[model samples]
Each structure stands twice: as C-alpha cells, then as structure tokens.
Target: MKFYSPLKNTICGVLTAGLLAVPLSFSAVPSPAAEADASSLIGAAIGGIAAHAQLNAVLRKYNDTDEGRQEYFQEMKKQLGVNEDYALNHQLDRIMTNLTAGIGAVDPSIYKKPYHYFINNDKSFNAFCTLGHNLSVNTGLYQTLTNEDEIAVVLAHELGHGQKDHPAKGARRSLNMQILGAATGTQAGAVMAAVINNRNITKPMEREADALAFDYITHTDYNPGATAAVWQRVLDLSKSQPSSFQQFLSDHPADSDRRDTYVRRLTQYSGGHVTNSDGIVKVNTKVFTTPAAVGGMSSKERSYFVMGNLAAAYHNGQNKQEVTVDGNTVRMGNQPIMTCVSGDEPADTLAQRLRQIK
Candidate 1:
C-alpha cells in the first residue's frame, strides 16, 4: 500500500534501538475480555475503513522512496523492534487517534492531518518518527504520561518534526554517512558522527519541533505550557534508571531554550493575560468582590474558562454581563448562554483579561 498523500507524522526515535532492528511482540493477541476495562474511552476510529486505509498506506509508503528503501530505515525499525501487532495497549491507540484529530484540526493544514500512530512495547520512554510519516510511541511513554494533554504535546512535537521534514533529512544524513563510511573505510559510528549522528542537527531539529508544539497547544484546548513539562518529564525519565539508556540521553542534548520558550510563546499568544500556572484561566462565579478577598477558596469553577463568555462577564463586568461567540451558539452548563454577537467582545479578549487568582 502507498499514499501519494500530503500529511506529516513524526515519533521520537530510540537511538539505542538503532543498533539492531529486531521485531517486537508484546503478547499473543490479548483477549477481548482482558481489554474490556482498558478499552479506549474515545469511541472507535472515526473514519473507519477509509481512515485505516489512509494510515496504512502512509506506513507502507515509508518503504517506497529512496531514503525509505535505505537499509537504515529497515534496520532502524528492526533495531527498535517495530511491531505492528498487539504489542501495544489497544486503549492507548484509541486515545492517541482521537487526540490526533483534535490537534490536527488546529494546526496549519500544511502540517496537520489524521496521521497514523502506533505504540512500541519497549518499556522505555521514547517515540519515533519513521522514514516517512509513521508515528510510534513506546508503551513506557504512554504509561509515563501524566495526562492526555502531555501526550498531545509530545505528538505535536513529533508532528512539528514531520512538518519540518526532519525525518527524511535525518535519513538522508544517515545514508550519506553510510556512503562516506564505504569510501573512507571508516566505522559506521564514525561516519554517522559527522552528520546524522551529530548533536548539532538533532538538537536543533528537536528545538524546532518544540516551538511548533508550543504553537499547536496554544491553538488547542491543551495547555500551551505543556511543552516544557512533557519535555522535562522525558528528560527526567531518560536519566532515571537502567543506566544503559542514559547513553541515548547524551546522544541528543535537550534544549535549555525550551524553558524560556514555553513561557515566551504563551505570553505571546495570550498576551500575558492568562492567570493560571496551568496555562488555563479559571472563572469563578461565586460572586466574590475581589480575587484577593476570596483567598482562593472558590469552588464550582470547573465550568469557567478564560476563553468563555462567562469568564469575560465575570471579569470585566460591562454592566451587561455579556459575551460573543464568533461561530455557532454558545452553551454553558448545557444551557444556551448566548449567540455570536458582533457587538460583544471576542473570547480571546477574555483570555487576555483572564488571570489566575490563586
């Protein structure tokens, strides 16, 4: 199967696994009963057969191009023990697929679409962007992720690589290394170090992906600052234990700029109007005179958001207590809040005025 399609997908590669491309098997097919409790809370695949075909075709196309045909592509998968079977938790697959669509909806169409995703059984926290657009995350990564938002951040980062064409570029470098190795009679490791294996390229590619991910999150419901936390978690998890894996951490240096980048990007988008450390604004309707007076004891704030109208009315109090939605009807608490009003303030204004009281 092949796709002459336009879509980008990326997964973080495990450098250690690149030494060999062995196949992986998590288990014989898990029984339906065993999966009952762990099933994807996000319903079944959205596009059904068509979606499955698109995803599978993209995966197959990874082998069609010159770079894809290179032995490194196959060896890399093998070294990582690529498994297209039940090696992953089915529930996780469903969750990622759902989130993929949600994030894609917000990203530039040039870099966003329903890309196929898979999970490797490896118990280490890593992901990979395959030769073309295939995305894979390790089981350890899925389990290690604290929440769905972090997972989205990771996926967005990988997609950022895809959007930037880093995978194919990395492959080209690897291929060049092999040719140079043949010509100069140098070791593969020595040849790789000159380019693809060089930290110079890898780190920048990662930082680029990080920036793209930051942009994506701000456009979506996920916290824009999620990039830092997730990247930090990946770093911490990489250095945690089983010291053998630590070598991979050293292979590609983490970006210190990301710490500041996260804060800077959110401020750029939200104009520093955002109030919460979580990167989301919470609106309180308990009718407190001032945020300081409440002393942060307000509950029932679950329904309020900085981008919602109630948030605007609660904060600005235009004597009208009104808000406007640009598209479609606005609903709150399952009740019709209001219609899109040209005269009312945009939701983002509230997002700007929104600040964390705590």
Candidate 2:
C-alpha cells in the first residue's frame, strides 16, 4: 500500500537543524558493490521453498473477495488521504474515456469494473498502479503535464503494474519483510521497519512495470515518446527548484539512465520510426465534430465556423468580438473562427478560406 524508497535515509541524510540534507562524506556513502551484495543476500535468503510457503500464507489472508479489496483500498485511502468515491468514479472515468478513445479500441472486460485514481495533492510528480486497477497520480504531476498524452503515459505505466500482477507479488514481499524482521538483528529490523512503513522495494518490480507498460502502449495510439518526454519535463522541473527534495524524485527515483531506457525502448518498438514525426503517427483531427448546439443555436459550433468571420475580426483590429447563434453568444478573437449552421460547409471552400486567412 504505502510504498517507500529503501535507500531513502541513506541517500538523503537525517534532518539537522530543521533542514533535510544529504551527508557530504564519501565514507558515509554505501558503495554500489555493498548495496548489490546486500540485495543478493536478501534475495537468496528469500528464494527457497520456505520463503514461498511464507508468502503464500500471507497472500491467502486476502484474495478474491470484495471484503479483501475493500480492506486494501481503505488502507491506501488512509495512507494517501484520497477521496475514494470521486477517485474511483470521476477521475477514472475521464482517464478511461481518453485512453479507450486514444487506443482506438480496448477490451471491454477492462471496463467492466470501475478503476480507482489516487492523488496525494503533493507537488512531486509520481504515479503508480496496484492490483484491481487501482492507480495513484500525484497533483504535482498534473501541474507539469502540458496535455492528455503526458497523463496517459503515467496511467499506462500503472496499468502495466496491474496487468503484471505486481500487487500479488507485493503480498509475497510483505511476507519476506516479516521473515527478515523476525530472523535478523536490529539492522534487519530497521530494514523491515522501513519496508512496513512505506519502503520502496528496489527489487526489479518497478522496472518490470515500466517495461511492460512500454510494451502495452506501443500497441496503441498513445505515443511511446510521451513516456520519455514526461520524465524529461520532470527532470527539468527539478532543476528549477532549490533541490530535488520532491517526493516524485524520492519515490520514483528517476535519473538520466532511466530516461535513456525509455528512449531506447521507444526506438526499439518504433523500428526507426520517430514517434512525434509527421510520417509516423498522424492525429486525425477531422474525426472530431462540433455538437449540434451549445446552450442553443450551436454557439460552440460558431467557435470554429468560417475564415471570413476570423479575417473580419482580425483585420478590424479588434482584440475580441461577440458572436451570437440564436440566444447563445460566445466571445471570439485570436483563435481561428468557424461557424456551423444547419448545413455543412463545403470542404474546398472552407479549406481555401482557411489558407487565405492563415
């Protein structure tokens, strides 16, 4: 439920004089070799049949029931302070609608049960998904995203976690933590304590999720490049701040290497096709049509009606102009203007005028 970084305290040293800071001494730093050795030992200790049995026992405690899922959701909600109803319905609805449309089609089964969305309202850009289609997105992330594609990248990554059954594996991990806590001394206890208190398991699970998500979205209209783009944006946003003390960086733990991983993955999937290039994936904006009416007489339709209206308004040196369609009126100016009436405008006429106006 509450995921945390395993090396959080070590990498970012303890608070001193009310300020969180990293210790400067290289001697205090754990060498990469030492960290790898600890990981191997832990992996071996938890690899045998005994560990599997313990994990199965813990997993059996909660599985395949509304009660079990409800308990899990409650725990996460408490930890994240998420509004369950709104998250499960509203935000998820928007995400599902966009993803389903973007992908062109999706398996109907994926939509049978409503998905959940969790936002921590923190300024850090981090997102993850759990079992049962539960997703968490940070508010700090929303601020950085320029469009829906960036958000899609985050959601698709989390969806990868659910598709790969990461939560079920997480149950086994919880068991491993319990065993390590009981068997080893205080250092192990500290590790287990961190695990129980939101320690991020750096044990290849998140990487697997990233890879799986990369694969999944490649089959859809969502550009795989958006994955690398979002991270690059986050990286740039971090440099603008005083320090990279944000939770997004802490929990997700991204670096230049990870960004390169996404780029490599995109290249591999695209087969030399650039993602954002015109020849690769072209968005068919013509697919979208204005609705019949907006508050009456197609006010929304007039928002994109004709180039004469646009040219008149533009050449008149007016910053804004009011347009009325029946009782409904909308202000228009710099935006390319068009109007919709009962009949459709001829494509050639509209195209010629649009070119002249431009």
Candidate 3:
C-alpha cells in the first residue's frame, strides 16, 4: 500500500521493495557456518510467509471489491497530493473523456469498472492506472506535453494497461512468485529483486499496451501520429537531459524502439502515403525527406519528427494545401513542415519537389 512520491519514483519504490518488503532476520552470532546457513534459511522462510500474507491482504483490500478500490483511491490521493488547478483539471478531464470513449469503442467492457483519475502534484513525466481502474496523471506530463493528441497517446497507453487489468494481475503474479521463491529457499527474494529492478512490467505487456494505444488513438479524434511523435520527443529529450527522464525510461521500452514501432504503425492510418523505415520518411512510395542531424536530434531521430509532421498533415487534411517555400521553411498552408538546412536542397526546390510528389 505504501510507495514513494511522484508516480515513477513511487512505482520504482514499489517495484524494488516498498510494497513487497521481505524482512530478513539474522542471529547475532552462530558458532558454526552450517548453523548460520540454517538460521538464514529459517529467517527467509518466515519473511516470505509475512510478505506473501501482506501481498494477499493487499489484493483483497484493494482489488477485490468496489468499496475497497474506492478506499485505496482515497489513500492514493492523500499520498500523492492532487492538482486542484481549475485549468489543469479541466484539461485532464477533457483528454480523459475522449480517451475513455475511444477505449469504450474498442472494448465496451472498459465501462464495467469506469476509471477514476486525477492529476497529481508530482512533476514527473509519468501516469499510472492502478488497481480498481484508478488512474493518476502527473502534472509534469501536462507541463511537458502541451499537445492534446500527444497527451491522449500517453493516457491511452495507460488505459490499455488498465483494460487488461495489468496492475492486479501483476500483483497476483508477484505474490505467487514470492511464495514460489520461499518454497524453493535457494532463490529467496529473487522475484522481489527482479521487480525492484523495474522488470515486473514485461516487454510483452508494454508492447500490448502500445498496440492498444494505437488502436485507441485511431478511434478518437486525436491525430494518431502523435503516438510516434511523443516517443520521438522523448528520445530527443533523453539525449540532452537523460537524468530528467530516467525514472520514466527505466520501466518502459527503449524510446527509439517505441518511436520506430509507432512510426511503422503510422501507415495504417496514413493511407500508405506516409511511412517510415527506421526513420526514413517516405511519401507516396518516394523518399519525402531523410533529415540529417538538426538541432540535437540524430538523422534518424529527426526523420521521425518529419514523419510525424507528414503524418499529421495527411491525417488532418493539411496535405491538400499547396506546398510553398517561405524563407528556409516548407509549408502546407500555414503549417511548417520542416526547415531546409545547408546540406539539404533549397527550400523552394524541396517545396516544388514535395508538390510534385505529394
């Protein structure tokens, strides 16, 4: 029930031992090494029993019933202070509403246990859906991502986790593993160690959530390209400010992989005009742009950004606008697609090329 502050920090704490603590008791002194080993084993057995019991009680109290779930939510709010700013709350509400409807469209069973969510005061780029469909979004996520579509991508991903009941299922798995480890005696605390290291959320679960997010976003009015854009932004930010995102990046899949996955998925919604392979942007089966390192992003990283812009333009009908050159910028209507640099073709030339190809 207890965890660290912020969301990711709290999850890391729980993953480590905040919630799954297996206290180890040791004798002051043992005359013989054999006796010492026996005493240690005994202590592990006792600790394992206590940890198992505690986890079971947690499941019953928090995941078993609606009343228990509501009680846990109150406790969570108290632990992580809620953000009461009217504007922020309203923004979160609007985003959540859209995401909820989108999720319901994909799987109406989501309505069975309607989500309860609030913005937490924590300034970390993270959000979580815990037991009982209770959700919390970090204020930092809002502060970092101003785009509503990008925000929907994140919330939708968390909703995916909730739809599959990952939190409760993960907890149950942890409990079973704890009991198994205790029974084995040789691998005491192995499961706890793994979870503490942030390995509890397996890669498969993350992939599934990501896939679900893609589906959810497509169903909503939000631009689906933002799914790839968000990860591309994260990858770019991680380069200059790695420490700022460690807490988030630690548990999720690699940012580049995520970007690429969503980038490839972009074709599904883009009508195949826009597609990316490894970060190379292709429009209408032709290389639209292969962006080089501009700003702090690598060539590949920058390409995803270009791909996102192209996907957005196509998604929102901006692609119908005339491709024009204004200074070094290429624009479709008022939307700035990308800037031409020294190594690249002239903006006017590129704009004309895009017009022909687009």
Q: Each prediction's TM-score against the native?
A: 0.50, 0.52, 0.70
State the C-alpha lDDT per candidate: 0.44, 0.46, 0.72
Arranged by TM-score with the best first, the candidates are 3, 2, 1
RMSD of 1: 17.8
lDDT tens digits, residue span 1-358, model 2: 2443332343123212111121121112232352345654454354323434533543343334455555555565666665335643465567656664443343344554445656754556566665445666766565566455557767776766665556656645654565453323223224334433434434376677667655555555454555665565555556676254364455454655555677656544434321222111211212222324333223221222221233233434432343323222222444333344345444344434333323
- List model 1 lDDT by residue over 1-358, tens digit each: 1111122112113221332231111112223342333222111212122222332343344534445434334444455554565634455565455545555666546443334555655776666564455566766675567456667777777777766667656655554444432322233343224333323347778777777776666555554445554544454444555363454356454434454466445434543332333323333321211111111212111112222233323323332333333454443333233333343345444323422231
**Candidate 2's C-alpha lDDT?**
0.46
Model 1 spans > 4 angstroms off: 1-91, 102-114, 175-201, 232-245, 252-256, 275-358
lDDT of each residue in 137-175, candidate 3, tens digit only:
988887567767788899898889889877766766765
Cα displacement (angstroms), candidate 1, residue 320, comes to 11
The per-residue C-alpha lDDT of model 3 at residue 7 equals 37
Q: Report per-prediction Cα RMSD to one decimal.
A: 17.8, 13.8, 6.6
lDDT of model 1 at position 306: 22
How big is the positional error of residue 188 in model 2, measured in Å on the Cα after superposition? 10
Clashes in each model (backbone N, CA, C under 3 Å)?
11, 8, 2
On a 0 to 1 TM-score scale, where does candidate 1 land against the true structure? 0.50
Better of 1 and 2 by lDDT: 2
